[model samples]
Target: MNDKTQDIAIVGGGLAGASLALLLSHHLPQLKITLIESFPLFNSDNEKSLPSYDDRSSALSLGSCRILQTLTIWSQLKPYLTAIEKVHVSDRGHPAGTLLDYRELDDISDEEALGYVVENRHLGQVLLSALAQQSNIDTISPATVAEVTPQADEAQLVIRQGDKQQRLAANLIVIADGAHSSLREKLGIAVEKSDYGQVAVIANITSSGYHDGVAYERFTDSGPMALLPLGDFNDEHRSALVWTVDSDREADVVAMSDEAFLQTIQQRFGNRLGFFTRVGKRHIYPLALYKAKEQIRRHIVLMGNAAHAMHPVAGQGFNLALRDCSALVDTLCDATVRGQSPGELDVLNHYLSRQDLDQEKTIGTSHLLTLLFSTAETLPAFARNTGLFGLNFLPGIKAWFARQAMGVAGNRSQIAQPASSTAAEKRIK
Candidate 1:
């Protein structure tokens, strides 16, 4: 075997790739690893895709926070996170008793908080910065995989990188590319696609009233509209909005003037936060549920959006990816210690099964919730408020849902602790 095919090669270094790199770097410090980014840079730092600036934010479960914290990566992005003291879930245009407060769940249990909302820029910076200093990890920019072919033992990757083209071999191939992955398709892995027929509109807005760390999710006939808490910007409390709209209205929303648009937001949003004075850059993604028929192909393994593109309704895409990375990290580390191949069936299946179970359940529930809430005429009046009603009245059920949102629902790892409780405590103080 050639020297190029010794360790592992990771393609597409986004959230999934970066997290895996950090985990592997921490657990198997001596193992040689190379990460290749096909893009020259990411959108937040530079103009790559979408916009000049990405104002969209992500809802991070407390569970994910602890994973990063354990990896020594949390401190890097901690300054940019906006704590969520409570999450108010309700039907659109609902009144006081209609909402579900996360604090109520804690009264029946030990911890508090549903999750935290953080800007994508903050997370991108932390993952990027951590990768920059790792001596054992090689980061290659502006590289494209021209071809890949697996032999009896070694897998060859022909990469055409700016002004240079070369073939590299590795024991295992990892694909962390985005939702529509060319790498997975290259191996002829078939995926089932289910369009949600709605678009998730994302933008950062300056909320008129004080947020006080309250995140809100109001479900409408169109879809769930969530205003997640973020750090105050320019004396205004910033809240990132995810408004899922019918596919037909997506274009109009994207083209709306900032002032007129804020007015529209004010109408649909009502006066909970008083007003949404302004909106930063915006993005709209056509929501879909895409999952591969299989997770592995000989020497290759797919992770992140590539493995399964989930609906943003529940905000578990990245969380699931983090889970996948954790499992892969454990599998690879154990393999190295036990003198096994990183791409072996035994190790890969451990990672696959862990991800598949969560992936299936999350995609199933989120898709159903999306369909249920988005259908205005499909529900009986009382059925409309079932979940919210349960959240407001049911103690055991509410805390469980809150913990589920926090990514601490069923953590197998002791280090997989959540930060929402601590953040909630600080908010109370």
Candidate 2:
């Protein structure tokens, strides 16, 4: 093989791209992988240099935790992770509410909890550290793919790093840049976007009362809000807040004094976690659902936010992306065993066929939840409260929904399942 030729070239070194690289390296060590990113991946002096590795936190479904455990980095992440033992969901001024407890799940144990919450920086640190130890994977930082051209058997990339440029070819190219991927557009892959006319204000918050591993999802007249439990900092009870409000009021919310913001949030969320004591820096971004027109084509595959970006109301965005990664890796591993090329269109199509249903279900559920909880109209409000009330009394339905939230409800990749399970085989056939 030429020095410039690689088995796979992954664009974007954020969470998605980095995770995919690690998985591929772990499973297919013989395949040479190249990771290209536009930002400086690491800086010991300043950890928050990368935008994706900032102060925000991610909710990792139980399935995601299982998948990461396979990568051998879960031990490093455990100290920084906060388990979500229970999820409390309610509507403002409504008597109806529902609690999803990990104990209710048949296959899960208390130690496993329902899911976990980890700061993005800590997750990034762990993933990147793991990447550094992968002998088969090469990373190029502060670099961008200027262009991508698909040939008959492979995809070629033009990488720009400072004043210099280099051309590389790979049998397969994975795009995991982000929701607003410039490379996806450069390849003429269009994205369909649905604006929710709302924005999410995110920050880390400290409360007087302990969360006790409870995650709160509160729906108010303005929009839906989530207070995900966070590991205590400096002996203070803490949580990550994602407050969705109308786009029109975003400016006012961002400009409010810390005390005023806390007061307003206390009003909207009530005394669930007790009085809000402190809040960290605030970040705001508009909420929307974006899906690429195409996810797979010959040697090119779109992964992560590049494929689908959903509202955070249900916290399914990253979990869905992680599932896609696992399925793709399983497909590629099978292809390798059969002496098939990684970039073969048939292999790529098979991978998509396996994950399409999962993507559809997750995206649909998230969209529906966003719309249902964010609306204050009489009909939707009534239906929403009634549904919550029904869930409290419906054991089977509640369990199913809990599974969905935990990311184990639908078909999963073989690698994400137990060694003896036949569900993956059934899905493959």
lDDT values, one for every candidate: 0.73, 0.88
Estimate, for each residue in 108-222, the C-alpha lDDT of model 1 and write its tens digit. 2343345567777667777777888888888777788767787766577888877788778887888887788887788788999998888999888897798888888777766
**TM-score winner:** 2
Alpha carbon deviation, residue 142, candidate 1 (Å):
0.6
TM-score of each: 0.90, 0.96
C-alpha lDDT of residue 132 in model 2: 85
Per-prediction count of colliding residue pairs? 0, 0
- Candidate 2 lands at a TM-score of 0.96
Q: For residues 69-128, what per-residue lDDT tens digits would candidate 2 score against the true structure?
A: 788888899999999989999999999999987766564543577889999889989998
- Lowest lDDT sum, 10 consecutive residues, model 2, at 420-429
